[model samples]
Target: MSENELIERIKDRNPNEPEFLQAVEEVISSVSKVLKKHPEYHQLRILERMAEPERLISFRVNWLDDEGNVQVNRGFRVQMNSALGPYKGGLRFHPSVNQSILKFLAFEQIFKNALTGLPLGGGKGGSDFNPKGKSDNEIMRFCQAFMSELFRHIGHFTDVPAGDIGVGSREIGYMFGAYKKLQNDFTGVLTGKGPKWGGSAIRPEATGYGLVYFAENMLKSVDKEIKGKSCIVSGAGNVAQFTLEKLIQLGAKPVTVSDSGGFIYDEDGIDEEKLEHIKHIKNVSRGRISEYTEKYSNAEYTEVNSDDDFNPLWQTKAECVFPCATQNEINEKDAKHLTDNKIILLAEGANMPCTAEAIDVLQESKVLYSPGKASNAGGVGVSGLEMTQNRMGVYWTREEVDEKLKGIMKRIHDDCLETVETYELSDHNYMEAANIHGFLKVAEAMKAQGVV
Candidate 1:
């Protein structure tokens, strides 16, 4: 079937899964050339199989709250593809967790892992249990309960899950403990463990750091440098905090960091000292970004106005923009705002943060845009390293991990560039180039292995 025909069928079958359909559409649209060149893929229904998950497991998670009340939530695991190697991805714990969101993330992970040149494949699991207002004990109980059923399907050589969004070291510790007891084994069935355990060095900072590395390479392609470039980074989470850190290390002036409350704009630039304060505020206190203004008098915090069509944070004038927040945070109006402000570079630190309309605006404006699959692959890349370390029963120093991560990000950036050049695409279509490159790798692997 043709690309459009397949997409229509997918939409018909998944009428309520907007996010999943959007993700599949983006990839299928970008790989038209590849599909035309490799008609065998059509004969074998490669795209059809790729769009469907190998397994979708859903269960009810019941745990006790601090009040001794039983709280029930839904959980899911979408083992999308494992053609490259084992199933690998993160477990997000948020109220927004759903099959559609997890499927979209898992589908994107397939290409992202392929781009990392890692043997890891793509899968994602999570629960709708919000950890926001839950007590530590309550969160622990929920994670333990979530993993009770999850442990049956995941393992070191099977599916290796990591942390995402609300699933941090604390959550991972709880889940790993539960998995260990349930399986009666100690293995790398999970990543993002506490450093003293099996976690790799720089795992928390990998995605954000890799984003900056990718952005630097994009700037270099245009004969420009990251130094002195003003940057606006959304999301004050792990990805945003470390992205700001690496940008500072590269001599860039990152002017903003944000959270769900809103964004904080520091015109004087967020230096190392400011970054430390942010880390302490978000990572330790779990406070809002507005608290940043209380600590720094020069900075101003703005609350997100839902009534408005565009986020005021994106209206900030800057040379670089990093959307490190959740998906679809940047809409059409925000994209136009960035283009009007002449933003030169954009690298996603979050998965699919830009809406389809936002992407179109950026592409039309000739902005250098890097998709999350390539730009944010660093976190998973390091997780893949953690898997290797667990199997070897050894650990690497921080320097070694960071150096290897840098090399991997550079290779991903160069590969995207080379693909765009080879396709003779107008301007630097990194988004399309990235999709095509990663897709080809997985498609070839699937073909070689024969239809499953």
Candidate 2:
């Protein structure tokens, strides 16, 4: 059967899994070229096996609320692939978490992990448990309940889960504590641990920093530099915060950051002092983005208008933009606005932040677009470092980890370009290059391991 037929079968087998289907179609389209050139891959039926997960575990998380009410949330872990190494990925906690979302994330993780050139596989677990407005005790109890089942499936040398979205260091600590207590062993089964524990130094900042570093490379490919360029960034969470921090350090003028409520635009750029305020508001106080204007009168905060077809944040004039918020944040309309404003580079910090149509717009407009799988692997790459640190029983300093991360991101950027050259594909879209490169490695590994 043809590659397109495989996609249809996938959709039929996993109905209501649009996110997972989207991810599968994107990568399969890239590898389809290889299948057409070398039909052996088709004869071996690699796509059929690669599209399915090794295992999908779903469980019910039961906990008690502060008021003694029984609360339950559905949790899932989709161990998509382990051809390279143990299952390595993050666990998100949000109301939007579902099997489709986790499957897409895990599928993307497979390619993302492959691009990192690290001995890591792909998996993703999360629940529809929203941590918003939950008391500390309640959150801890909920996490303990979630880990009670998750702990059985994960280990240091098996599947190592990290924090994502609503799952932060706090959630990691709670889950780790529960895992330790239940298993009666303290192991590095989880990443994003507090610094006092086994967490690596630069893991929190890695995704954001890595996004900038890769974007910088993309810029250099065209003889451009970011030293004095204006950047518009979306999201004020962990990824967006550190992205702004690194942009400031690199002498770029990043002027915007957003949250669910809306976004803030600061003409003077987000300085160190202003970034500290943002960190405090986001990481500590958990306030809305509009609060940014309260402290700095010069900055402007625009509340989100749900009726609009696009976010005004992308309509701003800038040379570069980072969509660090969530999936599908940049739709086709947003992409057109970006091209109209001459935003040259877009590197995703969040998984699948750009819709397929949006990507078509950016690539057609000559924007240096990089997919999250290739660009945001820094987070998982550092988690691999944390796993190494755990096995070695020694932790590296912040500077040491930062240098290694920069090197890894550089290699990924170079490898993507090299693979594009080898495949002779139109790299106006870097996703095709990254997807093909990542697919080749994992497909070979799976082929080597046989028809298991």
lDDT of 1 by residue, 14-60 (tens): 78998999999999999998888889999999888999999999999
Q: How far is candidate 2 from the true structure (C-alpha RMSD, Å)?
A: 1.1
lDDT of each: 0.93, 0.91
Instruction: Give the lDDT of residue 53 in candidate 2.
Output: 89
- Score candidate 2 by lDDT: 0.91
* Model 1 stretches with alpha carbons more than 4 Å out: none
Q: Runs in model 2 with CA error above 4 Å?
A: none
Task: Specify the poorest-scoring 10-residue window by lDDT in model 2.
Answer: 420-429
Per-residue lDDT of model 2, residues 296-373, tens digit only: 999998888868889898888999989999998998999999999888899999999999899889989888999999
